[model samples]
Target: MEVYSYRSDQLAASPKEVFQIVNDDEQLKKIFTILKDIEYSTKGKRSKGAKFRITLGVRNKTYRFRNEITEYVENEKIVMKTKLKQGVITTLFSVEPKGAGSELSVQSSIESSMGVRMFIMTVKPVVKSVMNKEMKKFEAAVISEN
Candidate 1:
């Protein structure tokens, strides 16, 4: 398994505000350009055990994945687990109060087969670059909403 993580700079928002924005599917699609679609596969309050089908467009190809909310803590954290053909990708989004604002942290772990692991290692730099760009967009969105 391989892991990647990043913590955003402080933004002019509260932890609850950050959590609300992150959980809003419509806002997320607008903030993250690579995301094509996100539809909830399970119906209920926004909490742990909920599922979603996500579609992402990357380099002209569309990739779809099943994502489940493994853990959720209002105003604090959310953990999503996505299953890939060759592996599982777990992502955690956490927010904490910082002075008058809040900071958001994101972490992603990839557990894959040997072949997929080798492939990931080769493109790790590219993956990191894309992730950084996405994070920047997220930060901008949060700040703009403040």
Candidate 2:
């Protein structure tokens, strides 16, 4: 498994508010420019078992993947899973209150079959770097909204 983690802080928002923004499709689209579209399978907003199709831009290439929300804890955590061409990907978002704002942490893991391990290893650093940059953008977006 290849693991990558990123963390960011946004001012003047609670953990709940941060979580709401992260889970909101409209808000996320505004924050993540790489997301061209998000299609939700289950209605009524984000929750465990809900599936979403996300179009993302990676290294000048656009990739689409179907992801399922596997775990959720209101105001605290969310976990999602997806199968990509390279492997099984799992992402966890954790939020915690910080003084008058919030701290958000994202942890992503990519597990590949033996045959594809080398591919995953080769891309892990690039993926981590991109995720860190995106997380900073997310923090700025949240702060601006507040």
Cα deviation of 143 in candidate 2 (Å)? 1.2
Candidate 1 per-residue lDDT, tens place, 27-129, comes to 9889888899988878943689999898988778888999999899999998989997767889988999999998888888887778888867886776688
lDDT (Cα, tens digit) per residue for candidate 2, span 1-146: 75678776655678877776876778888777777799877784578898878898877999889999899899999899987787778999898888788778888888657756887778778877887777778887777767
Clashes of each: 0, 0
How many residue pairs clash in model 2? 0
TM for candidate 1 is: 0.90
Q: Which stretches in model 2 have alpha-carbon errors above 4 Å? A: 9-12
Q: 127 in model 1: Cα distance from truth in Å?
A: 2.3
Q: Scored by Cα lDDT, where does model 1 land?
A: 0.83
For residue 118, model 1's alpha carbon misses the true position, in angstroms, by: 0.6
Best by TM-score: 1
Error of 1 at 56 (Å): 0.4
On the 0 to 100 scale, the lDDT of residue 132 in model 2 is 76
